[model samples]
Target: MTAERPAVDPRWWGPPIGGVAFALAYPPVDLLPLALVGLWPFLWFLDKELENAPSGSWRGAFAGGYLFGLAQYGALLYWIAGLTGFSVMAVPAYVASVMVMAFNGALTAGGCALGRRFGIPVAVSFPLAWTGVEWLRSFGDLGFTWAVAGDVLANYPLLIQPAELGGVYLLSLWVVALSTAAWRLVRPRSDTPRTATAAMVVVVAAAVPAYGALRLDRLERQLEGWPTLRAAAIQPNVPQDMKWEEAFETEIHRRLSVLTLRVAPREPELVVWPESAVPSWLRYDPRTRALVPALAAQIEAPIFTGTNDADTLTGRSGREAGDYRVYNAAYLVRPDSIVSNRYAKQRLVPVAERVPFVPGMATGFFERLSAWTGQFSRGEEWTTWTVEGFEFGALICYESVFPSVSRALVLEGADFLLNITNDAWFGRTAAPYQHASHLSLRAVEHRVPFLRSANTGISGWVDPLGRWRERTPLYEPATVVADLPIPGGGTPYTRWGDWLPFACVLAWGGLALVGAARARTAPRGRGSVVASSTGR
Candidate 1:
C-alpha cells in the first residue's frame, strides 16, 4: 500500500511567523549568523505550503505573500512615525502613512499570485516577481521604492559586490534562491531536488568568495591611487517648524554663511550645502546673487547651495505674471562665473511633501488636499555638473532611495554620487541610519564613490565596494571632508541591469509550464498529487 499523504498541521503558521520575526531584526548592531539564516523559514513555508496545493491556488499564494510583505514593511518602517511630532494633531498623518505602506504590500501579493500560475517555485518566483513589482512601483505618481528586499543585505559588504552586474535586484535574487535551496535541503526529496539544492550551494559558495576576493583586490588598487581633494560640506541646523517662517530666513542664511566661511580656509575644491540651505527664493533676491558670488570668490572654489526659483509665464487667466515655483536646486558658483545646475527632487515624501491616492477615492478630495503649496514639480532628467575634473550627480533628500534615478545619472556620465539632505525632520530616530544604508547599495551598484551632506546628521562617504569611509554623528552639526577616489570602471550590474532577475522569472515560468503539463496527463486518484519538478 502507498504511504498516506501527511496532513498540513494548523501550526503551519510557525514558519511564516518565524520569517516575519527574522526580517524585523535588521540594521544589526552586531553581525550574527542567525540573521543570515533568518529568511530560510519563509522559503520553507512557501515550499511546503505550495508543494501539494492545487494548481489554481492563486488566492492562497497571494494572501500568504501579502501577509509576509505587510509584516516586513510594517516592521522596517515603524520608524517613520518618528516623522510625526507624536502630538495628537499628528496622529492622522502618521496613520495615513502606514496605510499607504500597507497598500504597497498588495503589489507584492499580486506579483506572487501571478507567478504561481506558471508552477514556479516560490523561491524563484517570489524574488523575480517582487523585483519586477518594485521596478513598476518606482515609476509614476504612486511610486515608493524605499523598502526593497535586497536592502537587508546592505550590512554585509562582501556579499554585495554582485550588485555591479545586476543591481540590487540581483542581490534579492541570490538571497531568495539561497533561502529556498536551504529549505529544500532541510526537507530532502527527489534526485532533482537534491541536484538543484547542491547546484545552488555550489553557485553561492563560489560566488561569495570570488566577490570577496575581487573586492579585496579592487580595494588595494583603489587605495594605491586615492585622490585627495579638500572638500567641505555645510550643515545649517534649522528647526523644521520655523524653516518656512520669514523671521527665521535671515538666521538660516547667516548660519550657512558662517559655516561656509569657517571651512573656507581648508580650501576645498568643492563645498556642498544641504538642501534648501538658503531659505529665500534665489531668483527674487538680487542680494543673494551678489552676496553668493562674493562668497564664492572668497572660497576660491565652486560653492553649491540649495534655493528656490520662479518662472515667469502667462497664467490660464491670460494675465502675464511670474509663477513662484519651489525647487530643491543646486547652484555651482565661482567668483568669475556662477554655473547653475538644478535637479528638482524626483521622489517627494508622502503626506509630509505629497499625498498618494486611493483607488476609487473621490478626485475632489485629492484635488482639495493637493491645493496646498507643498507640491513641487519633478525634474524631467538628470544632469551631471562638472567641478574641477570630476562630474558628479546630485540626489536631493528623498531622491537617494531610488536607484534608477541615480543609475540614469551614472549612465549620463556621472563620475561620483553626491546627495544633499535635511534629515532634521526625522530627528534622532533610526530613519537617517536606514536612509544612509540605502545609499551604500547605490555606490556598490554603480561602482562609484558616494558623498552625502545632511542638515543635522549622518553625512558620510561610501566607497565603490559599499564601505563607509567616514560619517558624521547623528543629530549633530558637523562636516565630513574626505578625499574620495573615483572609480572609472563600471561593474556588470551597471552594464546589464536587472537581467538576472528577469532570467530567473523566465526560468520559473518555463518550469511551471512543464509541471502543469505533467500533472494534467498523470493517472487519476494519486491522492490529489502535486509535485514540484525541480527543487532549489
Candidate 2:
C-alpha cells in the first residue's frame, strides 16, 4: 500500500510560469512585446498535455489555466492591496477578486482545449477563446476592466488609436491573435507551414500600426483648427489619511486656494480641482458652497471642483420628504459668482459607495466594515458642463475606465472629457499610473481631448489623436495648465459603439459550434483529426 505515489505532471508548472510572463507585460515592468509570448508556456503545456491524451484530459486544461490566472492576476493587481491598506479585510478581499478573475482565465484555457480537441486550429482557437472570455469579464457588477492585455499598448498611442473602432477587447483580440501566431511559428507541429504562420504574424503586426498611423494623420489634420480651452488642472497632494479630517478642511481649502493663485498668471479660462478637493460637503455647508463662487469671481475664471451634495426627495404630496440622497457631485462655478451646473457621478465604485443590488449591504456587517467610507447614491443622468465655449463631460474617479460612460457623453454633444479623481487613496504606488493609463484608451475611443485632475499626481491631457501632454509627476503638488483642443465631430466609435467586438464574438461562437458539431459526428475513439494545413 506504501507503493510508489503517482508522478507529478511536469506541465503543472507551465501556467505559473506563463503568469509571470503575463504580469511582466503590464505596468511597473511594461515589456510590451513580451505580451506576444506571455501565453506561450501555458499554450505549450495545453498542447502537450491534451493533444494526444484521452478526451477526459480537458479537465487538466482548466486546472492549469486557473493556476496561470492566479499567478497572472495576482501579480498584476497586487497594488490593490496598497489602495485598500487601511482595512484589515484588504488582503482577503483582494485575494477573493483575484480568485474570481482566475475563473475567467480557466474558462479561456478550457475552451481552447475543447476547440482544439475538436480539430480547430490553435491560432484561431486561442484568440477566439481569450477574446470571448475577456468580453464576458467586462460585464456585470463584478466586472473589472483593469490590466487587460491591450492596456500594455496604452503607452504606444499610435498603435492603439484603433480602439476607436472596437473598444478595448478588440485590442485584446489583436494581442492574443499575435501571441497565438507567434506560438504556432516557434513550436514544432505536424500541421501548417512555419513560414506561412510567420508571414501572417508579420502582416498583423505591421498592418495595425500602419492603419493607426494613417488614422492619426487624418484626425490630427482635421483637428488643426478646433477650438481650444485653456485649463488649470490642480493637484493638491493631500494625504489620504487626512483628506476627510474635520481639522484639515480649512487647511486643505487654503492649500487649493494658494495653488489656484499660483496658476493665476497663466489666466486659464477654467480652473479645475481633483475629486472631493474640499473635505466638507459643499451643498450642505453654506460656507464651502459660497467659497466656490467667491473663488470663481476672484480668479475671473469658471471653476470646476468635486464635492458631496444632498437632495431631499419629496413625495407627490407637498409634505416634507422623508427620504434624502447624497451624491458625489461636481460643481461648475461661473466667473460671475454663480453656481451654474451640478452633475452627480453615475457609476459609483461598488462596495465603496453603494453595494451592487445587495440591500443587506446597506445595514449589515458589510456596512459596519465600510462605515468609514460614505454610502453615496447614484446619479441618474449623463450630464455634461460648458465653460469657455467648450462642452465637456465630467467623469468621476473610476468612471473614466468605463468606455460606455465617456462614449455616451460624446454622442450627446460633449466636446471634451474631464476626469476628476482622488487617487491619494492609492498613495505612492503604481496604482495611480495604472489608473491613468486606462484613460488614454478612452481619449482615443471617443476622439476627444481627455483631461485628468488627480489628487496626488499623473494628471494630464490627451488629445483626440492619442497624443498626450501636460503630465504631472507622482505625489507632487503641481498645477498643469494646458490649451486642450475640443473635438469638432464624432468618431466612428461614437456612431456605432462596440459593434466590432460584437461581430468578433459572433464569429468566434460560430466556429466553436462548428467544431463541436464536427466532433460529435466523428467516431468516438477516432481521436482528433490533425489538419496538416492548420496549426494545432
Candidate 3:
C-alpha cells in the first residue's frame, strides 16, 4: 500500500487577520462580539499543522502564534506611539514589550499541539491551554495584563458581574470555552455532533447574561439605602509637557485653586485630584507644602492630590540626613495639617516610571529620554485616608490594573476606592479609556465604589455595582461631584482572589504532562481521526 500524502496547510493569511478581531474588542474600536470568535481561526490553523505537518510542527505553530500576537498587540497598543514626543526610543520599547508578551500566543499554540499529539480533543484542550497561558501572562514582575480577552465586556456591567467571582480569568475561561464550543458546532467531527455542541454553547452563552441580569437586580436591591459620601473629583486638564515646568507652576496652582473653589457649592466632603497633580514635591518643597494646607484650609475640606514625595534616610543605614528616596505618592492635606498622611505609589509604570533590575546609570539614561528621573521606590503598605469619617484608599496611576491591590485596600477597611491617574502622556489615544475601564472591574471585584480622577479625562465615579455614575470627556477641564454609595460588605471575589486561575494552572499542568507522556508512547503513524480532524 502506498503511503498517504499529508495535506497542504495555508497558515500565512488566517492567524494575522484573525488577530485584528481581538484588537477591535478593546477600547477605541470596541466591537466586543468579535472577541468571542477572534481566536477561532488561529485554533483552526493550529489544527491544520497538527494533522498535516510532516515534522517541525512546533516551529510552524510558534511562528503562526507569534505572527498573531504581533498583529493583536500591534493594533491594541498602537497608542504606544503616542509616547514618541517623550522619547524616540519609546517605539522600540513598545515593540520589545509586545514581542515579549506574544509568548502568550506561542504557549497557546504549543499547548494545543501537545493536546493533539495525545488524545485530548480541541474543545477540551484549546480553552484550557489558552486560559492557562493568559493566567500565566498575568504574573511575574513584568506581568502585562492589559486587554485580556474578557475585558471587552467591561462596558457591559451586567455581563461582567461574575468577575467578582473569579476575576477577569473566569470571564476569559468563559470566552475560550464558548469559542471552542462554537467552533466545534460549526465544524462537527464524527464523534461529536454539531447540534450537541451548538446547544451547549447556546445554553452557556444565554445563561451567563441571564445570571448577570439576575445579579444586577439583586445588587440594586442590596444597595438600596446604602451609606453615601459626597465627593468632588478634579480633572485639571494640564498639558504633560508643561506640567513639570517651573514657569507654569503658578498657573497650575491657580487653575487648581479656581476649580476647588468652583466645587465649593457642592460642599464636597472630600476633593480628589488626579495623579501627579502638582509637579513639585508637596512634602519637601516649602512653598508647595504650605500652599496645600492653605488650599485645604481655604476649601474647608481635606484635599487629596498626587505629588512627588521623599523619606529622608538621615542616619538610617549609615546614610546622611540629606540622603533620600523619592516616591510617586499621594498626599492628604487637611485644613490644620500639611502633608499629614501619604501613600507612596506601589505599582509604578513599567518602562516610563520604572525599569526593573537595571543599573542606575542605564536607568537614568532611559528616564531622561522619557523626561523623568530614575525609577521610584515601591510603597510597603496600603494607605487609606479618612475624610469626614468616609474612608477610601488611593490607587495611583497604573496601580488599579492589579486586582489584588484594590482588594487588599477593601479588606483593610476601605469603604471606597480612589484612582488618580495622569493619562496626558497618552494623548488622545485609547490608553486612557482602557485604563479607566479597569476601575469599573475593580469596583465590582471588591464591592466598593471607585472614584477616578484623570488629569486629562475619564474622571468619574463607578458605583458598587460597577455602574458609571458620572464620566467626564477626554482633555476637558471638568469637576464631577457625586454622592457615591458605600457597600457594607465585600463580595465573593474579595474573599477569594484568583482561585480559578490557580485551579486552571493545576489543570493545565496535568494535561501537559499527560499529553507529553502519550506523545512519547504513541506509535509513529497511528493517529486517530479525532486527534487529527479540525471538525470543519
Candidate 4:
C-alpha cells in the first residue's frame, strides 16, 4: 500500500501576522480587535507544531518566534520616531528599539512551542507561556514593560480593577486565556470543549462585575478628609532642542515664573515644574537660588523644581576628578531652609539617559551613542518628602513605568505620588498619552492619588480609583490645578507585589516540564502517528 501524504499544514502564517496585527492595535491608537484576529493564525500554528513534534525543535520555534516578535515590536514602537529631531535619525533608532523588544517575542514563541510539543493544550500553554515571557521581559538589560497586553484596556478604568489583585500581569493573562479559549472552542475536537470554553468565558465575564462591585463599594466608603491643597503644574513649553541650551535657561525660568504668578491667585500650596526645568546646576546659579526662596515665600508654600547638581573630589588615582552628576532631580525649596528632597532618576532611558554595561567592551558604541547623554547617578533608596503634613513620593520622567519603584515609595509611607516629566522629546506622539495612562494603573495599584506634571501637557491627577480629576492638553502650554483626595489605606497590590504572576509562572513551568517528560517516554509509533497527523 502507498504511504499516505502528510496532512497539509495551515499554522505557518498565524504567529507573525498576529504579532503584527497586535502591534497595530497599541496606543496612542487602537486596532486591538483586528490584532486579536491576526493572532489566531499564530495560535493555530503552535497547536499543530506541538501535536507533530515528539521532541521540541528549538531552532524552528526560535526562528518563527523571532520573526513574529520583530514584526510586533517594529509596528508598536515605530512611534519612537516622534522622539528624534530628524526622521532619518529617528527611523534607525526606532528600528533598533523594536529589535530590542523582539527579544521578548522570540522567547514567548519558543516557550509556547516547547510546551505544545509536550501535549499541553493551546488554551493552557499559550497563556502560560505568554505570561512567563511577559514577566521575564519586564526585567533585564533592555527591559521595557511598555505596550503590555494589559495596557490595551487603559482607556477603560472599569475593566481594569483586576490590576489590584494580580497587577497588570493578571489582566494580560486573562486576555490571552480568553482569546485562546475562544479559538479552541470555535473549532472543537472534543465533546467537552464547550464546557471548558464556557468555564473560561464565565471566569472572564465574572471579573468585570466583580471589579465593578468592588469599585462601587470602595467609592461608598468615606475617604478620610485631608486639607484641600491647591497645586500648580508649570508648563513652560520649552522646545526640545533649546531646552538644554544656555540661552533658553533664562527664557524657561521666565516662562515658569509667569505661569506661577498666573496661578498664584488660586494660591496653590505647591508649585511644581517639569523634570530638569532648569538646564543649569542650582548651586552654581546664585541668581536662581536667590529667586527660589523669594518665589517660595511669595507663593506661601514650597517650590519643587528639577535642576542639575555637581560635586568634585579626588579619586584613588590622586588626580582631582570632577563628578558632574546630571540628575533628573527634584528640589523642595521652602522659605526657612530649602529642605532639598532630591530623587535622582533610577530607571534612565537606555541610550538617551544612560547606557547599560558601558564599562566593558561596549564602551566604544556607548561613546558614539553618548551624543545626547545625561550621565546621572542612580538613586539608592526611596525617599518620601513631607511638606505641611502631606507626604509625597517623587518620580522623575521615565521612572513612572517601574511598578516596583513607585510601590517602594508607597511602602515607605507616601500619601500620594508625584511625577515630573519633560515629554518634549516625544513631540506630539502617543508616548505622552501612554505614559500618562501608566499613572492611573499605579494609582489603582497603590490606592494613592497620582499627580503628574508634564512639560508638554497631559499633566493630570489620577484618583485612587483610576479616575482622572484633571488633565491638560497635549503639546499645549497650560496648567492643571485640582484637589486630589488621598486614600487612607493601601490596596492588596501595594502590600504584596507580583506574587500572583510569579505563582502563575511557576505553575505553568511545572506543567510544561511534566508534559515534556511524558512526551520523552511515549512509544515511537504513537509519537510518529501524532507527528504525521499534526504536521504543519
Candidate 5:
C-alpha cells in the first residue's frame, strides 16, 4: 500500500499572506489603511496553530512568524538588491537583511506562543509581544528601526500629532490595539461583540481623524507665530560609482558650485548640501577647503556640507600615539572663510558602511568587504550648528531615521533639523520614499521643522506638524529653496525620551509571568483555557 500523504494545514499559508499584507501597507502600493488589517492574518494563524497543536507548538509558531517576517521584510527591503545593482552580492545582502530583521518577527510570534502556552490571551499577548520585540530591535550594533507598523501614520501629519506626547511607540501600541479589535471582528475567536469591534473601528476612523484635524489646525496657528528662515538644499544627482573615481571629482565640484550659484538669488540664510557632497576631505584637503569657503562667501550664506574629517589620536604618551580615525563628518563653512563646527555620523549601516563587531583577529574578510566602502569611526556626541542666528542639528544620512538621534539633537536646543544623505545607492526604487517616512515622525515627535537633502532624490522639507513639501524627483538635479519654520521649544518626546517602549516591555514581561503562574495550575488539556482566553 502506498503511504498516505500528510494533510496540509491551511493555517500554514497565513505567514506569507500576512507578511504580504504588511508589505502592501507600505509605499509603492500606498495602501495606508491596509496596515490596520496587516497583523490580523498572522495573528489568526498563530492562534490556530497554538490551538490545534497546543503541545510543543512554540517552535512551529515561531517558524510561522519567521516566514511571515520573511514575506514582510523580503518585500519591504527588496530595494537593497538595487544597492549594488544586480550583482553577485546583491542577493546575499538582500537575503541577509531580511533574515536578520525576521528575527524580531520570530521573537514576537514565539514569545506570544509561549504566552499562549502560559495561558495568556491573544488580545493581551500579541501587542505586548510585538511592541517588545520592536524595542529589542532598536538597540545594539545591528539595530534597525525602519518601517515599523506605527510608521503607517507617518504620511498623515494630523494623525501623528500624538507623536509629540508619546512618540511613535504610542502610535505603535495604538495600531496593535485597533488591529486586535478588527481581528476579533472577522474571526469572532474572542467573545468581543461586533458592536464593540465596530465601535473601535469607528473611533479610529472618525474620531481620531477629527482629533487630528483639530490638532493640525492648532499646530498650524502655533507655527504662524514662530520665526522662519529661508534655507536652500542642493541636489547634485551625482552617479554613485563615478563619484568615487578620481577623474570625476572636479566635475562633481563644478556641478555643486553651479547649483549653489543658481540658488544664490533666493538669498537663503543657510545653504545645505547632501552627504559627502565632495569626495575629498574638505577639512584637510587644501584645494577643496579653499573652494567651499569661496562658494560660501559668494552665496553670502553659511554652507553646511558633508565631507570627510580626520584627527590624529594622541594617547597618554602625548606623542603620535594610538591612531587617527577617519569620520563621516559635516562642516559649516562661513562667509568669513571659517569652518565653525564638525558633526560626525553616529549610526553607521552594518556591512555597507561599517562591518558589525567580530573578533579583532577574525575581521579580515569583513574588513575586505568594507574596504571598497571605507569604514569610519563612530561619532561620540550629537552636535547642533548655528548660522544666521538659527540653530539646527546636522543628521548625516542614516542618523535621521533614528528617533533617539533626532530627539537628542532637539534636547540639545536645536530649533530645526537638517538631514543630509547620499541616497544614490537606493536607485529608482521605493527605498528613498521608505527612508523619508521616518523623518516625518521625527519631525512631529519634536515639533520642529526637518529638512532632508539627498544626493539622488526624495529630498524635501518636513514641517513641524509632519507635513511634507513637494519632494524632488529621483536622479534629478535641483535646488529646493525651503522655508524652515523654527520652533522655539521642545516637545514631550524630546524632554522625556522614549518611555512607551519600556512600558510595553514591562507589561509583556508581567503578562508572561502571569501566564506561567496560570499554566502551572491548569489541567493537562491546557490548550482549552488559552483558546477560551483569546479575548483577555
Candidate 6:
C-alpha cells in the first residue's frame, strides 16, 4: 500500500522561500518582525512530507530540509566568505560551512518525519525536532552556536526572558511556537478553529512581553540598589591585514597606549582590550611586557588584554616532538606589577582557527589549509578571574556564541562576563554586529553583565537585563568607560544547563518506543488515520 502525500505547496522551491524569509529575520537585513512567521512556510513543507511517511517517500523531507537550510544559513553566514577578502579558499570555506548547517537542517526535517511515523502531531514534534538538532549543533569541537534561531531576538529582552529558563534554545522554541500558531491560524486544522488559534496567539503575544516588562522593572529597581564596579574597554579598531605585521606593531602599541591613557582619567577599576590585542607573545616580548604593566600602573587599575602566548619563553616543545603549544589567551596585569591570572580561548573557529575533526585525506587537506589560519591548542581550564573584589570571566573572540562557556564560568563564581574579540577580518560586514548580539543572550541567560571589547567595532556593554548600554560604531577606534552594576545568584540556565533540549531528546526517545510497538501491533488501516490528521 502506498501512502498518499498532500499536494499542498509541493514544489521543491517552497523550502527555499521559507529559508530566505527566516534569514531576513536575522542581521544585516534584520527585519525583526519577520521572525514571527518566517518558519510557517517551512512548517507547511514539513507537514506535506509527513503525509507520505512510513511508506518511505517521507525521507524526501531531508532534501527539502537541506534546501531550506541553504537559503537560511547561506545568507546568515555569507559574511564568512568575506573573512579572507572573499578569496578562492574563502569561497569553498563558506560553501562547506553552509552545506554542513544545511545537513543539520535535513536532520531537523527527518526528525519531524519520525514524529509523523509515530502518529505525533506536527505541532508537538516540529519544535522539539528543530530544538533537539540545534542543541546538538552547539556542542563538541564542531559546535557552531551562531546557528541558534533564538539569537535573532537579542534586542527583544522581553521576548527572550525564557532564555534565563531554557537558554537560547527556549527562545528558538518560542519562535517556532509562534510560527506554528500562525501556520494553524492561516490554514486551520480540522480540529483547531482559526479564531481559537488567533486568540491563543494574542494571549502568547501579550503574556510574553507582559512577563518581560515586569522583569525589566524589577531589575531596574534592583540595579539602582546594587553595588557597582567601574570598568573600561578599548576598541583598537586595528585593520585585520596590518595588525600582525612588524611595521604596524609599534603603531598598534601607540594607539593602545593613547587610548588607555585617555581612559585613565576616568579612573576605571579595570580595563580590557580586544582579543589578540598584542599580536606577539606579551611576556616574551620584553619591551611590551614592561610597557603593559607600566601602563597599568599609570592608570592604577588592572588591565585585561588578549595576547598570543607560547608555553615557554623560547618556544619549548610540548607533548609532541618538535612542536610547541601556543594559546589565544587573556592576561590580567595589575598595577602592583603582578600578572594575576590567564584564561585561554577553548572554542576554536573551524578551519580558520582549528581544523574540524574530518577523518582521512580531508583532515590532511584541511591541516595544510590551516596554514593560512594558524591553529592554536585548545584550552582546558574554566578559570575565572578576580580584580580587587569584583570577579569576572573572560570570553575570547567567538566563545560568546557558545552558551556553555559562559555558564561554566558563572558556575566557577564569576559575577560578570567580559568578551574580547577581534572582528577586523569580518571587515564592516554584518558579522561584527551579529557577533556582538550574542552578549545579550549570554547576559540574560545568567543575569550577569557582559562587557565586550572588539578590535574593529561593535564594542559595548550589555546589562543583566539584556539591554544594550553603549554600542560603538564599526571601523571606529573608541574607548567605553562605565560603572556597571554587578549581579549575583544563578539563573535557571546557569544552574541547570540545557534542560530544555535534554527534555526534547527524552520526548523523542519516548516517541520512538511507542512507534516501535505500534509498527508491530497496529493494523494496516491505522496508517490511513495517520495521513488524514497531518497538517500544521
Instruction: Report model 1's TM-score to 2 decimal places.
Output: 0.85
Q: lDDT values of the candidates?
A: 0.67, 0.79, 0.79, 0.71, 0.81, 0.81
TM-score, per-candidate, Cα-based: 0.85, 0.92, 0.91, 0.89, 0.93, 0.93
State residue 72's C-alpha deviation in candidate 3, in Å.
0.5
Evaluated at residue 248, the lDDT of candidate 1 is: 82
Write model 1 residue lDDT over 137-174, tens digit each, in one string.
66666577776667777877887777777887777666
Per-residue CA lDDT of model 4 for 1-536, tens digit only, reads 99986584346566678788876666667665753455666666565555546555656666667777877777767668665663345666687888877766677667766665655555676677777777777675566888777777666677677777777777778777767766666643533358867887778757765875778476647554544456778877888888878877778878888888888888787888888887677767887887877877877878888776655646799877654445557788886647476666777776666666563223355656665543555556677788667788888887787777788888898888888998887777677888888887777778777778888877878877777878888777788776767755677887888886687678778877776576567666754422433422
Encode model 5's per-residue lDDT on 1-536: one tens digit a residue: 99876696788888889898888887667687778887878888876877665443789889999999999999999888776652456677788989999986788888877777666666777777788788778788788888777877878776788888778887787787778767877774566678977887678656556767888988778877888999998999999888878899899999999999999998999999999999898978888989999999998999999988887877787887655777889988998899987788988886666667742212467667666444677888789887668778888887876788998888887899999999888777888888888888998889888878899977889888889976898898988988888877888888887788888888878877876676666664535554445433
Clashes of each: 5, 0, 1, 4, 0, 0
lDDT of 5 at 73: 94
**Model number with the top TM-score:** 5
Please state every model's RMSD to the true fold in angstroms. Answer: 4.7, 2.9, 3.7, 3.9, 2.7, 3.8
Candidate 5 TM-score versus the reference: 0.93
lDDT of 3 by residue, 282-353 (tens): 877888888878888887898889988877666656767665567889978888975666799877666666
Model 6 TM: 0.93
Off by over 4 Å in 2: 1-7, 54-56, 313-323, 359-361, 364-366, 369-374, 523-535
Rank ordering of all candidates by TM-score, starting from the highest: 5, 6, 2, 3, 4, 1
RMSD of 2: 2.9
In model 6, the runs with Cα more than 4 Å from the true position are: 1-10, 52-56, 86-88, 188-191, 312-321, 358-367, 526-536
Clash count, candidate 2:
0
Sorting all predicted structures by lDDT, with the top scorer first, yields 6, 5, 2, 3, 4, 1
Tell me the spans in candidate 1 whose CA falls farther than 4 Å from its real position. 1-12, 28-35, 86-118, 187-199, 202-206, 226-229, 313-324, 337-339, 356-364, 371-373, 513-536
- Model 4 lDDT, residue 452, Cα: 83
Q: What TM-score does prediction 2 earn?
A: 0.92
